[model samples]
Target: MKDNFSGHSDSYSKFRPGYRSELISYLVSLTKRQQCAWDCGTGNGQLAVKLAAYFDEVYATDLSENQLRNATPKNNIQYRTEQAEKTSFDASQFDLITVAQAIHWFDFDAFYAEVRRTLREDGVLAIVGYALLQVDESTDKVIQKLYSDIVGPYWDPERKYIEDLYKTIPFPFHEEKTPVFHDEYQWTLEQLMGYLETWSAVKHYMRDRGENPITLISETLKQSWEGFDTKTVTFPIMLRVGRL
Candidate 1:
């Protein structure tokens, strides 16, 4: 089955964590010039919107029309309906190119070919991903059980690239060492549930089994969240940065 995200664009836009400003600043620091950046697979423009502050222009592309429709618009950001592997822009057009949590879905050869074509000789390419979110120990255990036991099998095989932090992807460029980064969020039980519902595996489980898996663990999670006005969740952000 194809990896489809159009159906959950709303939840994705609302619940998916945004990158830290420090991360964006770090990526910007690597660029020779901030004239242009292309944010490939920019679901809801999370990274694209952040990139707008640094680049003179940001081209954000996604294959899903619904995703682009829900993207936050900025004066410097241009949202486009285009595949990651095939964009219409000319050669050597970007000072930087970034992919946020969506590189696993790409046809690597085709996408990298396009990247080599569009990126300037001095341009940088950044691929970013976040590890699983963690709440308190008890709550995390409950969520981990749900992830590993309940929805694990439902996740696409492509998820392994992210699980390994994209170590296996053919990254043929001068690599750069990046500082440690994490995206942190404070959320109530309800908010946590909303975020969990946005997982692609959870969505797949619901569609395949015709039952919401979150419902199976809701009471357990609530119990674990007891006495907590809000829970702190953190995802360790992973980056693969290189120069062309």
Candidate 2:
């Protein structure tokens, strides 16, 4: 898959939001066995660390060594540098497999082939992500401009999958109906800025334009953020679950 976050691995581990417990609980509930799990494109081991608590073993893989290096260590979680489409995993190895916020970067057909090869017959494959963050209407307006007007062209074509909430992505399995979930956090303007900087589109813009794009909207964000030092930023979680 793509290795966009490796350069800013530390910032990604620090600024990226964690998955809600409810989401994790639901994934666990779907699994018939908690024997093992594979978290592909597991940047910073965010989801793997949580899976470690439920599974006997958690294998987390990513293309970037820098990202793997920054991953949180756990006794049951084994971090590896590997691609999403190919791996050394044995057939019928994992009870559950997950790709959080990174499936858009994968070769879907190849990855699905690997999933079918390695995943147990009853195993669940969960694809998870979050939509654009929503603050108040005023703050959202400035952020949307930055997202659409400033760095819109910089975003990769794969981003449309997230925009459509994964509905448009190819899913060739027995899909399960999932409940809607959200990640809510009380974040300062600085935190929001840091999160924005983690966007792959922002990185692309910086590389092409030779300047940070967030600067274009800093003052406007501050002006719109005036009444509150901290505000609840909600990200509607996008999830698609299925079985082999």
lDDT of 2 by residue, 1-244 (tens): 7788889999999999999788999999999999999999999999999898899999999999999999999999999999999999999999999999999999999999999999999999999999999999999999999999999999999999999988999999999999999999999999999999999999999999999999999999999989898999999999999998
Instruction: Give each model's whole-structure lDDT.
Output: 0.90, 0.95
Please provide TM-scores, in order, for all candidate models, with all chains considered together: 0.97, 0.99
lDDT of 1 by residue, 20-66 (tens): 89999999988889999999999899999999998999999999889
Off by over 4 Å in 2: none
Evaluated against the true structure, the overall lDDT of model 1 is 0.90
**Candidate 2: worst-modelled 10 consecutive residues by lDDT:** 1-10
User: Candidate 2, after superposition: displacement of residue 206 in Å?
Assistant: 0.7
The superposed Cα distance between candidate 2 and the true structure at residue 142, in angstroms, equals 0.6
Instruction: Output the lDDT of residue 30, model 1.
Output: 89
**Native-to-model Cα distance after best TM-score fit, residue 213 in candidate 1, in Å:** 0.1
* Candidate 2 CA-lDDT value: 0.95
Clashing pairs in 2: none
Q: Pick the candidate with the highest TM-score.
A: 2
